[model samples]
Target chain A: MGRVSLAGVSKTYGDPGQTVTALTNVSFELADGEFCAILGHSGCGKTTLLNMVAGFETPSAGIIRVEDQPVSGPGWERTMVFQDYALFPWATVRQNVAFGLEMKKLPADARAAIVDHHLDLVELTGFADRYPDQLSGGMRQRVAIARALAVSPRVLLMDEPFGALDDQTRRYMQEELVRIWRREPKTVMLVTHSIDEAILLADKIVVLSSRPGRIKQVLSVDLERPRDEDSPDYLALKRYLRGLIHAETAA
Target chain B: MSGAAAGTAVPVILPARRANWYRRLKPLVLLAGLVVLWQLVCLLWLPRLDRQIAILLPSPVQLASTAGKLIATGELPHHLADSLRREAVAFALALWAVPLGIAMGWWRGIHQQFYPVVEILRPIPPLAWIPLSILWFGLGDVQNEFIIFLGMVFPILLNTLEGVRQVDRNLIRAARSLGAGEAVLLRRVVLKAALPQIVTGLRVGLGFGWMALVAAELVGANSGLGFLINDARSLLRTDIVVVGMLAIGVAGLTIDFALRGLARWLLPWSQQQGGR
Candidate 1:
């Protein structure tokens, strides 16, 4: 069975006059240990769908299930990395990463160990005591990644996690994400607009149409993990993904 | 190595320690200069103290003598205690007002329902309510406390409401995603996000409260800095009035400095906003 599955989901926001249909009958399943990407335009209910699995929002229509159980409330088994990093500015990197474990009621030693372990994984061990303000954007995002991974969630939902970083930093983050995924494979659902990014990370690229987003197409990457962006195959795949987006817009 | 790099300079001293000392002393030196000019003006033009001439605004020498005698007589401590009590009571009462304001502010329906009434209550000045407070609680500590509470609560409530409203909607969504229920959301996310602004509000409110406390005390209270100056007015003790005035300024300045330090310690994240 899939680790994270969405079935016939729809979400409408607000009252009749100002109502916004954010998602319409969207369905997908993330296979265990696969890195899946949800690619769509900015307004395309992509984040909303992710919010459902994160248990931030319940589907207005259908249902979403995590590990074959109906997603009732936000579970510790699934963690989300927001686009803006959302690192508590008042907290040190270690404290921010320790938040989930602390919520889980882990003993201090165990929680500290897990926080240290993830910080090491993200190559931020030296920055544990440093506050988010003291760190650069890239470093902050790395700390955020560590914070999410520290919880050891079964399914990781990344919503434009590297969207705020510069190009070089974004590339570095993507590579690091792939490396982390290899170290400990969990069902990963990443939402992004960059076709190159989706191609680089996703085992399957799930494309959505514009507004009131629905699954327009799902394309298998066919390329291997830790894929090279400079390679001809990766570029070709990116062009194909871009073409799909253009086609959707044109229609 | 000894030669000056610049064309005009014979020797490069790296601007002497004397220059650094001068730079540090500049503001105090400027203040001293202003004092001398005022003294000179007073010496040349003003004849005597009739309270009519603006130039007769008590000389530093006169103020020191007045201040010294007031302290020697133990009136300073008595007045200071009275002022401190009013401030302490008002501050405690203001704390109670914040959660009440938050309840009204956080919930949309509550805000709508209470906003009109709150707005109506807010416009009436704390000073205007002095007569009623005196009538209701009589001329004592209770009346003084009531007036201070009235003075501070409006600004505190307005500030708290603004802080709650200003909290990022995204943070709320993020908290909900983390399994933060209503209680957790209020305690963890909402309160944390709103704190810096609330502190600012509290600071402003406390300042107004102090001013109102003095005003309230001046009317009928037997003790306090305000009462000290006021009673001195009838006795024609200008020295005590001057001492009382200076004491209020110094005390207010000290409390404001302490509050700024508290804001820094409490909201470390606030400084990192990076102009955004």
Candidate 2:
């Protein structure tokens, strides 16, 4: 189980005398196996918060704990899917998926097995031998997802994983992500700016105010799976969250 | 639908055969034109203008005949073999320099310690060390090899350092997030990312190395293309000198072509992506 808790997490950059705060007095808790989405405007420190949770950055003023242990540096338990789909262009899709497993010093056969499973999970079994440059934008992102999942991380942190994709591909990937998340239940923290995306996929949505980011609200999503956009309940929640985000960004 | 149907569904395709033929023959045509121009200037035009110029610069026919005589006596082949041997040794030494370059690029301390020394030494041309090389190795292949080594090492070293420094920060961060430690990060990500640039460095270094080879051999070598040219100059056999110059140019071109092929084979992804 991967339960992450951030208490009064504040990140300030530059010297203390002349500093710029990115996140201020931010607190959130993601329960085990819960899919949480941090929704905020650009420069609202959503990525900084996610990076802190991923242990890529340290919080200036608060404690971030994952499964009761203080976060240190990047660990295998918290794999990230970056927005740019950072698949190694030199490695084939199969090899890219196997990267984390190899880092963990798994045997060749086991590594191959896990890589094949993840590739198949992403429906990219046929393109196993192709490099990232040979794949389309969506295909590369799927490869990134497969690579991240191949290690069986305790928590998956995705930083706007589908932001670079077109609308059609983005919608398709959102569905694919949910389907995959259900099949392999792990605590997931997705950072995104899209209100509909947050409402559609997240079990809980945390909205933050712009600049020197502070938590504005945390709304628990109680809608059923495969929530319809046209449904009154889904639209209502989307409108409410959009209003909240719009207000924060506008202010 | 009717209006669209009236327009041609498929664009007319132009036959690429003529264009392909022209592209294929372009270099040879240009080279032949250059030779014709040279023959016209030296054999026909220059002698009319100044008889002494014709005596100094051999025409294409004279050069060809001289090359034929050398080939028949196997002298050209022997000299070429010696020169190639020296080149191979220098190139091998240059290959050894790559690891040090990689270390310097990867570690900040190493870069700090060695980079200033490299910067100070790099601007001084390799040929400037010819006298020192002669004093040390004393009129042998080792002296020529030293000059070539000096010429080749910097391009490989600097290019490798730049390649490592230019590796995408996001790629490293992504690898770290996937549990890669320092060694794994260097081996799997940094090395692979830097490879295309390294290959480019090797190619550039080899070109400089070949240029230095002639300079090195000119000073004190007994059996190389440079020596061939120097000997012909002393003997007043301008045709043989021209032949030696041609041989060096052709050999350099051939080796550069081979290295390019190697780069293409080693980095298929870079080729596909149209990376240099």
DockQ (Cα-based) for each candidate: 0.35, 0.61
- Taking all chains together, the TM-score of candidate 2 against the true structure is 0.92
lDDT for each residue of candidate 2 in A168-214, tens digit (9 for 90 to 100): 99999999999999999989999999999998999999998988899
| DockQ computed for model 1 against the true two-chain complex using alpha carbons | 0.35
- Report the number of the highest-lDDT candidate: 2
Model 2 C-alpha lDDT per residue in residues B1-276, reported as the tens digit of each score: 785664564243233656778889987997899989998898778889898778899999888898999999999999999988998999999997678888998899999999999999999999999998899999988999999999999999998889999998778888998889998899889989988888988989999999999988887899999999999899988989989999999999898888888888888888732234
Q: How many clashes does the backbone of model 2 have?
A: 0
Candidate 2 wrong stretches, greater than 4 Å:
B1-23, B40-43, B47-50, B272-276
Considering every candidate listed, which one attains the maximal DockQ?
2
Model 1 misplaced stretches (Cα beyond 4 Å): B1-20, B48-56, B109-113, B179-181, B272-276
How many clashing residue pairs are found in candidate 1? 0
Per-candidate local distance difference test: 0.83, 0.91
Interface C-alpha root-mean-square deviation, candidates in order = 2.2, 0.9
